[model samples]
Target: MSDTYAARAWLAAADPDPAHAELWLTYTGVALMPLGTNWSAVRVQERQGLRVASLNGPAIHDGPARAVYFLVPTEADWPGGMGELLGGPSCWLGVPAPERVEPPGIYWLTPPDGSGLLVDPVALLAALCEDGADR
Candidate 1:
């Protein structure tokens, strides 16, 4: 499962000063990965798309979907602290994976800009954190 997740993003502090605990945590993962962006501060875009299957209880798999977006800042917030979010649908954020082991489509929060937050897949069953914990 871990090996199934190859693509990733790693965010880091714009400055060299002591970064916030939260910021450091983000950089630890998102700062060292490749991404696609024209004008932005920092973001976590889904490269492998998403999987929405009612049979599997709606999961985030390494497959393709109809619509793929981002969790950018609003128009007014664009190029600002948060860098105006445009796509990266929030539904894929904390889907029993990202934010936490909840379930299919459910996003309750969106952190700040220049922050590190993305999604991946664990094909192997044994690698799942909340395997039988659901049933």
Candidate 2:
């Protein structure tokens, strides 16, 4: 199967009902690292400067919570002090359909490109720390 198809299928499998909806509860293989909106916005802008699409990975802008959730590999050892890392069997992320980019609700800050790429945890931590110090 193509990467896009496989990725969509995997995401869809997370939903128990799997119906067409604005959001679905999905269990991702990657850990969800939620950072404050300000910090995440800065990181996103910085990553965009590199002009490498995959470097930013898949991220969600949770409008209600005012946070950005960055998807990182499950094995990545991110420091808890940096942000809350939600993963494993108990955590379920509210994922928007691949097409949901606009927002009156939760939306993608950086949507998945179907390459299965994820943000670099090391780079993320470095950026957060550097930016955190300023704020």
Candidate 3:
């Protein structure tokens, strides 16, 4: 069988810092791709209109589930950090993926005021970290 883990879809958040990200991964049973490897291994997105209640698994393709959502830090309107984002039935933070860990998948984006079109993480990383951006 494939080496993928089976899990219900859900939004997960890292502390956006090295130490907290590490601890979050460990305590939640999610696998870490190592320090310098996170760029290529872990998927990240800005944010979107994903309904938090419907997340059940990865999307039909190599991307995020339709119901998954994320917070973006690069937006000029971004409230600075996740702490400023609102959490509710559709958005959340610090929660681990539902069931088990799996290979990194697509991450969807959301805006700062919790509005607007989603930003692609790949594009954001490329513009921001030109030196080590993932393809």
Candidate 4:
């Protein structure tokens, strides 16, 4: 799939480190659920020199589609703080499910607490930022 303007800008925002952009655009959708707001009113903002894309959509209730994609800015980056902030399980980006694992290459989030709104990772993440997240 060709990259959209937003995708390009998003990647550029990542600047010297485009890894997150790559993951977001290639493997998983990235939804930036900003602080002080519900998932419904997600808004994009620049944080620490990164373009945060906030996405929204109906949650997908299925075994393989109940995950969100997030880019770890650094190898040390994880969802511990974000999860604690959200007062729920920390949503750390986990390894991509094996091809043998049904969906194949679908990014997985960690903790697997199994009790949150079932959201479409692709829509939730891709729906943000001018539809660049979609393919």
What CA RMSD would you report for each candidate?
Answer: 14.6, 7.8, 14.0, 15.0
Report the lDDT tens digits of candidate 1 across residue range 11-130.
Answer: 222222324423433443222111123112122123312211211211232223222233222221333222113332221121111332222333212222222333222221222223
lDDT of 2 by residue, 15-43 (tens): 44444321332332232222221122222
Estimate every model's Cα lDDT from 0 to 1.
0.25, 0.54, 0.29, 0.29
Q: Rank the candidates by lDDT, best first.
A: 2, 3, 4, 1
| Clashes, model 4 | 4
Evaluated with TM-score, which candidate comes out highest?
A: 2
What's the residue-level lDDT of 94 in candidate 4? 26
lDDT, candidate 1, at 14: 22
Residue 133 lDDT in candidate 3: 35
Residue 66 lDDT (model 3): 29
Which 10 residues in a row give candidate 4 its minimum summed lDDT?
Answer: 40-49
Query: What is the per-residue lDDT of model 3 for residues 1-135, given as tens digits with 9 covering 90 to 100?
Result: 211121211122222354554455447644222211111112223222222212222211123342333333332233222213333234323333333333355321221111222334444333434423332
Task: Sort the candidates on TM-score, descending order.
Answer: 2, 3, 4, 1
The TM-score of predicted model 3 comes to: 0.24
lDDT for model 1 comes to 0.25
lDDT, candidate 1, residue 99? 37
- The C-alpha TM-scores of every prediction are 0.18, 0.65, 0.24, 0.22
